[model samples]
Target: MEHANDITLTVNGTRVSRRVPARQHLVDFLRDELGLTGSHIGCEHGVCGACTVRVNGEIVRGCLMLAVQADGCTVDTIEGLSDAKELEALQKAFHERNALQCGFCTPGMLMAALDLTKKNTKVTREEIRAHISGNYCRCTGYQAIVDAIEEVVNGQG
Candidate 1:
C-alpha cells in the first residue's frame, strides 16, 4: 500500500485538494496529479533545474521538494505564468532568438530566467549566465538564451 495524505494548496491561483503519496515529489505531483507538465523532470537530484517552480514567491527545484511540503503553499508553474501572460515578452524573445531546441530544459530555463529578471531588470550577460547556471541546455549553446534574456532585460524583447 502507498503511504498518502490529503492536502490542500493553491496552484496557479486555483485552490485544490488531493491525496498525494508521501514519497511523491512536487514535480510528479504537479505533472501527474494537477496535469501541469511544463515543469520537466531532469537529474531528479536538484542539480539540474529542469523541474523549477515558484513556491510562495521563491524558485525551488520541484524534484527536491515533497508534495506535503507544498500543502499550504502557493505554487506557480510555467503554465500559470504563460496563462497569466507574465512571460509573454520573455517567451517571444526566446522564440525570436531561437533560444530553445529540443525544449527539454526550456521550461526550467524560463522559470529561472523569470526569477532573475524579477530581481534586477538591469542585468548583464555574465550575470544572466550565472543566474541560470543551475539549468542545463544541451542545445543552443546558451548564447541564444542569454541574448534573449538580455533583450528582455533591455526592454527590447
Candidate 2:
C-alpha cells in the first residue's frame, strides 16, 4: 500500500494543503493534484530541467523532489511567475526571438533563465548558454533560446 502524508506548501503565492502519496514527485503533485501543468515531466530524473520550479527562491527539479519535502515551503511554478508578470520580459523576448518551437521545454527553460537573470545583471552569450545548459530543447538548436536570454540580460527585452 502507498503511504500518504499531509503537506502544506505555498504555491504560486497561495497556501495549499493536501494529502499526497509518500513517494509522489513534486511535479506529479502540482500537475495531478493542483492542476498546474505548466511544468512538464521530461526525464523523470533530475537530468532534464523540464520539471524545474522555484522552491524557497531557488530553482529545483520537481521530479527529484518529493511532494512531502515541500511542506511549508514557497513553491513557484511557471503559471504563477507568468501571472505575476515576473516573466513578462523573458516571455516577450522568447516570442520575439522565436526561441521556442515545440514549447515542451519552454516553462523549464524560462524558469532556469529567470534564475540566471536574478543572479547577474550582465552576462555574456556563453555565460547565458552555460546557465541554461541543463534545460534541453530538441527543437530550436538553442541558438534562439540563447539569443532571447542574452537580450533579456542586456535589458533589450
TM-score of each: 0.96, 0.97
Q: Write the per-residue lDDT of candidate 1 for residues 1-157, one digit (tens) a residue.
A: 9999998999999999999999999999999998999999989999989999999989999999999899999999999999999899899999999999999999999999988878765987899999999999998899999999989876764
Q: For model 2, how does the per-residue alpha-carbon lDDT over 21-103 read when each residue is reduced to its tens digit? A: 99999999999999999999999988889999999999999999999999999999999999999999999999999999989
In TM-score terms, candidate 2 sits at: 0.97
| Residue 1 CA displacement from its true place in model 1, Å | 4.6
Residue 154 lDDT (model 2): 83
Q: Candidate 1 — which pairs collide?
A: none
Model 2's alpha-carbon lDDT is: 0.95
Model 2 residue 16 distance off true place after TM-score fit, in angstroms: 0.7
Give the residue spans of candidate 1 off by over 4 A. Answer: none
